[model samples]
Target: MFKSVLVANRGEIACRVFRTARRMGIRTIAVYSEADARALHVREADEAVLIGPAAARESYLDGAKVLAAAKATGAEAIHPGYGFLSENAEFAEAVTAAGLVWIGPPPAAIRAMGLKDAAKTLMIAAGVPVTPGYLGEDQSEATLTAEAARIGYPVLIKAVAGGGGKGMKRVDKPEDFAAGLASAQREGQSSFGDPRVLIERYITRPRHIEVQVFGDKHGTVVHLYERDCSLQRRHQKVIEEAPAPGMDAATRTAVTDAAIKAARAVNYEGAGTIEFIADASDGLKADRIWFMEMNTRLQVEHPVTEEVTGVDLVEWQFRVAAGEPMPLKQDEITLTGWAMEARLYAEDPANGFLPSIGKLEHFVMPDGIRVDTGVDQGGEVSQFYDPMIAKLIVHAETRQEAAEALAEAASHVQVWPVKTNAAFVMQCLEHPRFVAGDVDTGFIAAEGSDLAAEPLSEMGIEDAAHRLRHFAARSGDSADSPWHSLTGAVGFRANAPTRITQAVVVDGEAHVARMLDDDDHPMTRLIGLSVTRVIAFENGSAFDVSAFARGGSGAGNPASDGSLRAPMPGKIVATPAKAGDTVTKGQPIVVLEAMKMEHALVAPFDGVVGEVGVSVGDQVVDGAVLATVAVPDAR
Candidate 1:
């Protein structure tokens, strides 16, 4: 095996690769941009190097810089830990040219499956069943329209270089084909530097199932079963499970066969995933599955496959790169238990699922659950990168058990100081159809509201009480206060009624949270408000936390914690702090950018910065804390 390796990506995936590399006694090198200098991945690596600025263009995505980091660190191999340069054939070629092992497929295989149009042609020639569509090389608008007409209505105009759903569009009618093609081509060119596209038949009620295939240079390959990636939002996978819930023997064999054929056609090596779009309108059948695309590196959802296969893909990558043959054959590989993975992102389910960015205040990973996280509490969720906060995976004896365990595990996971979809993921698992394994790509969009409802229940009182108690404790007041009685106790002090405006999720709808009158106690809570801005956990049926006193003298309530606004869901690109930095309100503490846009989340009110939690370039979700401010004492 190679003595050392370089991980060419950041975040949970980088940390994940390092974990396996460490277990195998392989020295791991981590490369980061200026923004991620203090990221978890950097801290976890055996050696680290700075690549460039926070922008991926200047850093992570810069293949040359990554190659240099590998060479400088004397890394025997470079592992593009998915995303960034993972699938870039040029990067793989560059890594090998730099005299280091590329822990991925050969450039020949990557190039063969790199472009959608060409890959489809290869698949068709390879005799793997393919969805009938246009794979012509014409770039003219008129030609694509003509092709769409030939394919019939509801055709998918996908960028030949597309993956992660970017540069792909579905047109239901001929009239919309032109615009969609144009959009797809533009996004494709911008995203992949390839503007070519292909037209495919859009299957209604499609179930995404991908086969994990590993090949060694010894011309041996084996399939690690399948993963159901049907649950998605915005064409991006949200939940994935291995050993597909409803998979049968015959169909599973057919899908696996086609996946292996696709791999063998390219002479694939290392860990690569073959995604197939299954037509579930009439239920899964061997013949109904068609090739989608090949993910030429480790997937974000690889953990699910690992949970079932008991195989460490990273270890295999190292072994394969070091000129090793397949240790096991297809017959020896077996799927044990069912596993599910949910990608918890910092996004607002209520607000059209917009990405949320902020700093983590209370960052705690759930116990008994496998959580791969990069940022800690006080880390900035910047808009500079993907908004994914963590991947929560669980395993069980059966699909039902796995589903239940996944829900329970998701419920226990928490990442406060920012908004997350953990609660929503639990709700999705409990959704009627999801529990029945009746899912599709439209699952999140169709039953989204019901699945995204974050009901607070009768615990707002308790949540508020907890917050109040914490406030009181911080202010050196009695922990046991009459918070329950004090809730909504003020009718109209003198001038105007107390006003509290918040957005709540009720039955999947965003409702204006009106300030409740003193006697208008319905008892039931809404949104995530246990009573009213309070919190209740799965272990509690009733929560009654005392209200915090102002002014902190044990007589009045403390002032509200200033709101920490998330610029948008992205990566934290930069910050400078050492815990003792005295900062005033509105002082620039950190620079956060999201969606290629930048913003500064400064001190909300004049106070000393009590904690500088995050460093430059950390991924954050919405509503996470960038820093904490300690209000000054009265003169």
Candidate 2:
């Protein structure tokens, strides 16, 4: 085993690898950008090195800086954890050429599977079933459109060099194909520096299933069953589970055998995943499953596979890098129980899932489950990296039990100030369709609005009001309290339920709440941000409210004003509307790129663009006004 290993990544995956390395008595090293100076992963490492600036291109993506850190720290091996330079073939070759171990597949294997079109070709040649698609090298738009016509409508336009849903789009008809192709190509160029794409027939009801395969340097490869990742939003997986719920023995055998063949074809080593797209219009059948793509490194949802198989994937990576044989043969590996993992991201489900960036004032993950996180209380979610804060993993004896346990755990997540998708995850876990194992790739898109419905009920308002009163009274003097003066401070029965009218502000809207002066309210979780403000947590969501002041109507800022502001700190990518341009409400005026996603700032009302404050490529902070519109004067 290597004496020391440096993780060429940041955030949760970095922390996850370090945990395993330490457990195996290996010294762990961490590299971080300036933004992650106080990050949890940095503090947990045996040795730390500063790589570069906060921006990923300047820091995490700088292969030279990472190699220098490993060299300076005398790191015997380098572990590229899941992202950044993990799948960069050049970096892998550089690590090996530097006389250091690379805890990943060989550069040749990475290059073989790096491009989707090339990988599909290789798989087809190797007799591995591949999805039918157009992989020709013609970069002309006309050629792509024709291929789409040949392939049929409702096809998927995927970047040949894309993963994680970037640079991928689905077109339902010819009218939408042009826009989808342009968007996919743009994202592909921006994300992977490749503007090429492939057209594939879209599966009506697709289920994403992938098998975890591990190969050692001695040419031993084994399979660890399959994981169902159908719960997705915007093509990004939200929840994943091992030992797919409805998979039978025959179907499992076929997928696993194909996965082994694909791995052997590439001479793959270390942890790799062979993803298959299944047409679930019918049940999971062998002939309907086709190769979608292969992830050349560890995956974000590998914890689910580990929970079920009782295997340490990171440990396997280390052993394989040391030229050791496979730890367990294919037949020795057993799936003990069901396991599920939910990705907890710092995003607002109510606001189109835009990344929420800020300090975590009251961050707390629920107990009694495995939580892999890189941020803690007081740490900020930076805009330069992925917004995922933690992953909640649960294992149970049955699939139903696993889903229920995970849902209950999600409901206990308590994050404040920085919004989270905890409530949204809980809703997905508890949905009837999800519970019945009747989900597909489009599940979230079809049910997102209902899943993110307004969570504050009447009972929540009343509970918040009563809590606000008690908090206000406690902050004030007991001898002379204005809240007590309102209630006369004279209650004959101490435990009796007394009715009182209390004024409270929920989300800046003032309300007079009639509450029983008892502690039996349904929503009891409350935290005081200030004397006048309190946050009530219900159903895995935080409701920020305040006590309504006397003679003061707590009205929030009007929403009809046509001010287009950046929702978070980011760089302006596009300004579609210029000054004096006539625009309608919900028109995309400015697009801000932050946290690796683009957000369109829309016009609040129909009006003429009065001013354009920022141009494309300008960086702006949260709430920075980018443009404004003036209503046409009615004469």
Candidate 3:
């Protein structure tokens, strides 16, 4: 085993790698950008080095800086944890040339599977089934349009170099193909420095099933079963489980055998994933599953696989990189009980799932389950990185047991100030179809509104009112006042109305609650940010309610005032409208890119664009005015 290793990444994955390295008595080195100087991973490392600025291109993605940091720290090996330089073939070769062990698949294997079109070609030659698509080298729009027509409507335009759903779009008709291809190519160039894309026939009912394959330097490969990542939003996996819920013995055998073949074709080393898209309109069939793409590094959902197989995948990576033989043969590795993982992100499901960046004033995870997190109380969720703050994994004797336990655990999460999708995830786990395992890639989008946080119940409102009164009575008032008498009577001015109503803000709207509070009431977790303000966690949702306050003077509602403002700090990626350009309601006015996602600020009503305050590539702060629309006067 290597005596010391450096993780060329940050956040939960970095911390995750360090944990395994520590257990094996290997010293862990962490590299960080200026933004992550005080990050959890940095604090946990045996030795830390500052690489560059907050921007990823200057820091995490800079291979030279990472190599220099490793050399300076005397790290014997470098583990490119998941993202950043993980799949960069040049970076892998650079590490080896620098006389440092690259704890990942060989550079050749990475290059083989790096591009989707090329990978599919290799797979087809190796007798591995691949999805039907156009992987031609032509970069012309005319060629792409013809290919889309050949594949029929609802073809998927995917960036040949894309992952994480960044450079992929689904076109339902010929008229939309040009715009979709342009969008995909633009994102591909921006993200991967490759403007090329491929056209694939869209599976109407696709279930994303990926097999975890590990290969050693001694030309030995084995499978660790499979994971079902069908619960997705915007093509990103939200929840994942091991040994797919509906997978049968025959289908499992076929898929696992094909995964091993795919690995052997590349002479793969270390850890990789062979993702397959299944046509599950009927049920999971071996012949219906086709190769989608290959992830040439450890995945974000590797924990679920680890739980089911009782294997230490990170340790396997280390061993394989050290030229060790396979830890166990394919026959020895067995799947035990089921495991489920839910990505807990710092995003508001109720607000278009927009990323929420702030200090975690009260961050707490539930007990009795595994929680892998990078941020703690008082840590900031910066806008420079992925918004995922934690991963909640649960394992049980059966699939249903695991799902129920995970749902219960998700409901107990208490994160405030910085909002999270804990409530949304809980709802997903508890949804009838989800619980019954009738799921596909379209699950989240199909049940979006139903999965959102429902309004606080009447009992919940009454509970909030009581808690407000309890907190208000405890502060500022004298001991001799009616508040200390333990009575339900509320203190008020002599000239006040007989039925006093206390105003409280929930989800930015004000609600009136008559003050008829009992001194003692059973309530959920509630924290007072101020005497007048308290955030209540009811049914796993955070409600920031302020007593006796009307409204906050932040950005004006665009529907009423025609002012489209930035909801958070982000770069203006596109301005689709300019001054005097007429646009209809809900037309995209400005597209703000933040936290690795695009949010469109749209026209609130049919009117002419009055002003476009920001230009493309301009970075604006929270609540900054981006654009406006004006109502035309009668002639």
> Per-prediction TM-score, please?
0.77, 0.89, 0.89
Q: How many angstroms is residue 349 displaced in model 3 relative to the true structure, after the best TM-score fit?
A: 1.6
Q: State the lDDT of candidate 1 residue by residue for 1-635, as single tens digits.
A: 78898999999999898998899898989999888888889989989999999888999999989888887888898888877888888888888888888899998888888888788888989999888898887778989899889889888888888888777788999877876786677667756788899999998899999999999998998899999999987678889999886899999999999999999999999999999999998888898999988989889999999999898888888898899998789998999989999998887665446666766644555568688888876677776788887998888898899888787777655454466777778888989899899999988879866876433332343344344334334443333433332332111121122322222222222233333344543322222322332222331011112232121212333573744545555456546444556666667666565553334567767766666667766877667877666676621
Q: Flag the better candidate by lDDT, 1 or 3.
A: 3
Instruction: Kindly state the number of residue pairs that clash in model 3.
Output: 0
Q: Kindly report which residue stretches of model 1 are placed more than 4 angstroms away from their true locations once superposed.
A: 455-459, 462-635
| Model 2: pairs clashing at backbone N, Cα or C within 3 Å | none
Residue 274 of model 3, lDDT score:
98
Segments of candidate 2 deviating more than 4 angstroms: 457-459, 467-532, 549-557, 576-587, 603-614, 628-635
- Please report, in order, the local distance difference test score of every candidate based on alpha carbons: 0.75, 0.83, 0.84
Residue 570's lDDT within candidate 1 is 47
Model 3, range 335-450, lDDT digits (tens) per residue? 99999999999988866788899887777788889998888866889998999999999999999999988988887677777889888998999899999999999899888878
Please give, for residues 1-635, the per-residue lDDT of candidate 2 as tens digits: 88999999989999999999988999999999999999999999999999999999999999999999999999999999987899999999999999999999999999999999999999999888988879999969999999999999799999999999888899999988887897788778877889899999999899999999999988899999999999988788899999897898999999999999999999999999999999998889989899999999999999999999999999999999999899998889999999999999999887668888987776778889999999887788988899999999999999999999998788767777789998899889988999999988999988876687345544445544455466545554454443433321111122213312233333333333333345544322223311344354555676654323232323344565777777789888778789889989888788787887667778877889988899878999888889998888820
